[model samples]
Target: MSESLVQAIASNQPELNVEMLEDIEIEKLGEGNAATTKEKENEKSKKRKTGAPAERIALCKYIILDELPFKAAEKEGFKIFVAEICPMFQISSGYTSGGCKREFSVSPRLTDIVGKSIGELLVDVVTQWLLPRLFSCTLDNAAANDVAMRHVHSKLNARNILATNGQYLHQRCVSHIINLVVEGLEDIGMSVIRGREAVKWINASPSRSRSFKDIAKIAKVDTSKFLCMDVPTRWNLTYLMLEAALPYEPAMRLFQTMNPYFASDLKERNHRKMSIGVPTELDWIEVKRMCGFLEQFYNLTHLVFGSHYFTSHQVLMELCDMIGLITDLEEDEDDGFRNMVMRLRLKLGKYWLEETKLNPKMNKILYIAIMLDPDPRQKMKHVEYCLKLVYGSTWANELLE
Candidate 1:
């Protein structure tokens, strides 16, 4: 096999000649033992014939499952590894691997991305893929998604493929709902805005970042975690930004004292005048309080988005905890904290409360999931207790009925 490979390389590569092949020594296995050379040759021939195709198939599966680049097979190291395992098999080139056709097709859509257009496009894709049935489609909390789901529900119902008449066909994305709830608290005060400005200034350049690290080191703050800037649209990112910056509060203050230019730089960039500036002592205190409040929502969001296990049964319990958190925070002495919790409560009520007209009814699936919990401690009784806590005994009784 090595001899053949050498010959092939010499033939293909203009730089290599037949003379170079003379210096290459090919080792003969099972050379002088009990077995004859003829028997060894026959065994190798049989192995090559039987193992080559299976090895090739396994290689293909590896590439596809790992999402590796097609050019991986063309590398010299890869060819050598293949030779060591299955010497008789010929390694395919990157172009050959890339040329293998996929089982799916891509269709371009030039239409607007509204509900009707999205619904039609989804139906077309489902048909093209020959999907027999779809249990549900999860989407974010967009008004357009509501319309899209309704269109999809009608189309699926016409074909008699829907279970429960498509009642559960539109599964609202839990993470997105959590985002909406957390976003209600985003306007807590100038504290958040100032904190965001601080992070932005620190991360603006390599020199600033290095200087901050030096300050952090001197303050004995953990230099392992770099400051993170938050996107206003994502509450989770904002939570992360605050969480990262909280520990750096000491470092930030020290840096500000050491570098008078820091505050001046922020002030110079403050076109939003009243809204943007360096974080004050009160700002850090408010940020700390906000972090404490946002932590629960951030954790709940993470749990719901987990991929290792089904999280439906866990949803109601976490949401019940959220209700408890909001109710407790409502009594906080800080007026800003209480106001923020009130807003969060209103947002939660819009989606989870039974009587709110914003959502005509709470999704029955959440209740069904909790009832299906296998744990004796977390069965229907626990759900009833939570409901009673939120809606009182009378409303809980009505819901139970």
Candidate 2:
């Protein structure tokens, strides 16, 4: 019947085509209903395809500050603080860019672990609370930490979830190791100690501090930034003290005349009068030189220990640059600087040797981290060569496993 109606329309007969046009309108309405039904089916199919909701698994790095001394908590015992930090993008949609989000798992309000073995306790906390999310752990280079890492590895292995077969379980704290290297330089130590003692005497009395500021003003030195005392354990504070005091040498000399406290304090502190109590002309010169020498370390420490982004790839390169700087300084003419440079070189070289030893599965982790970076990815021939040297020609193949 449809073929006959189409034939009549092709023949150009309007009277016969009128009924055919009405029938065509009825068929179009039915087709529209079928199309709507098909659309509903597609929506249902999509919902079925994504039945179980997708989850974003977050990766994090944990830092453990062992045995933090808090006065309030000290009534019971020392406290250990654990901080879990992760790149913001993984867990936070709003903070998708720039810096990591940090949460303290163990706050200072809690007392330190006692009676039970700390290593075992930490392992339990990590395995139970953080094992699902933690990527790696950073720790200070204390002898106790060596045992703790071993314990962590053993527990992780038992669960068959040890990352990289537990090879990269521990991250060496760069800041602490840098502090150790700075302490090893005896000449810098002497200059810093003298500067520290001078600042301490001035800070001990409000009158002396006020007088020192006035003297600095009279000497045309900028009084906007006041002198800061060095914390005994923090080498960075010593650097800051020397840096701030270097410009105030002339003012410090003039203030020594006005304040008898400076002399008496020095005398009392140095009972035998064995060392330079205050920063003399020579001491200031040494301080200036030490600051210059420490510039590379200061810069690299800030760079590698940044919280905003990953820095594991930069560790090897920065250490290499520092070693090169020390090697160049070794030939310097000054006897004191040469000795200091030698000690720094030796100290840094010890770490460099350990990192590049090409043995022990753990040491290769650093190289692997460098290779994983998109910017320096596979461009580090040194890392590749070391891996090849240690793991044979099939190192790339082995890395896959």
Candidate 3:
């Protein structure tokens, strides 16, 4: 809505549907239902459809750290442990192949006593559990496509990305797996990276089959050793499937090669980036799936992101630019960074209401693309005396498969 209308509502126009926040609603009782209802009503019946699992999922739509597993603070031996958290914790849940909702949580306990904060811990989890799992699977269909993978992984760097699981989760989730190596080479500790690179080269090469035997012999490793595992199963995305993988020389070679700069970079003080303004409702299962998908590509993710050529932030900016959201990319390249609140003034006759379309899918794409915008906090607002022909409210949450 327009700032003027918001101001008016906040001022003397209380009847215009503005209510000041006087209290916090810890219970998610009457919230989001209207968005849900409106979403169901407005979502057009399209030809495209995806998998629909039968299991019940508890989408964390919106949660607070206070609502997490830990209660207040605990008395550990000599100290009282407390959750040092930001103001919000937003997440989501979706059904798996078997109808199970997979929600995720990094080892806050692991990161806590271990020193890092929860957000950092989630990143580490993505490195370990998430990336590893991605390597264990193969991309086959539209559901298992590479382009989709790229969309998901690049989003990791967003501000507040850790707090929610919006549609962005599926964007390039597969590509994120492929990008693992890009992420790893920045740290030089991995000897296995080279071998894995060889595997990737072979898989990605024209003469892959012919070079396979020779590649294994030169690396003194054998891919044949990985026979017992079911190859690329779905859960492999979660477990990282390393247990099923033959840890022989062949497998070792593929897993060892990583970035030297990464280790050194890891030792350096971490520079924190701002959170993206989009809200999410992420789940542990998707996190696990994200982990499984990232395995081999963990180092790659580091590499892609580390390159001075193009940062994750830049990529997202390009996306937003394509949608005409980021104007004048050549001059003020950083305009996408502010909180964008699109102010809408639909001029019409006295008794008529103006209608507008806020397609959820387009909104999602815009939201993800905005993360890459040069500005981290850009938001939009629309102003109207009345929302005509619209569902219920200007703000809504839509669920799609």
Compare the candidates by TM-score and give the number of the best one: 1
As a whole number from 0 to 100, the lDDT of residue 115 in candidate 2 is 14
What tens-digit string does per-residue lDDT give for candidate 1 at 153-242?
Answer: 878788876678877778788888888778765566778888988888888677889999988999999646789988876888888899
Which scores better on lDDT, 1 or 3? 1
Clash-forming residue pairs, model 2: none
Q: Which of 1 and 3 is the better model by TM-score?
A: 1
What's model 2's overall lDDT?
0.64
In angstroms, how far off is 161's CA in candidate 3? 13
lDDT of 2 by residue, 1-401 (tens): 36676776758865656566777768998899999999987776565445322212211111113222223232322122111221121222322433321221232222122212556876778766755634467777654566667766777677766676776677768777787778765445566677888888787667778888888989899646788887765667777777777888889888878777686667566523565566678778878978777777887789877999988777766666676677678898888788878877667655444333333323455666777878754456766554454335575345434
- Point to the candidate with the largest lDDT: 1
Q: Which stretches of candidate 2 lie over 4 Å from their true place?
A: 1-119, 126-135, 185-190, 256-278, 303-305, 354-356, 359-362, 374-378, 381-401
lDDT of 3 by residue, 1-401 (tens): 35575666566755444333222222233456766876764442221111112111121211232243221222242122111221121222232455221211244443333333333444465666655332211232222233333333444534334324333343332234333212322221122222222233334334443444454466676344431222222333222333323233343333223323322322342223322211112322233323333342333334345635634333323322222321221233222211110110111111111123443222244233334555535322211111211223543222111
Give the lDDT of residue 303 in candidate 3: 39
Give candidate 1 regions above 4 Å deviation.
1-135, 184-186, 267-272, 275-277, 355-361
User: What TM-score, over all chains together, does every model reach?
Assistant: 0.63, 0.56, 0.16
- Please give the CA lDDT of all the candidate structures: 0.77, 0.64, 0.31
Ranked candidates (lDDT, high to low): 1, 2, 3
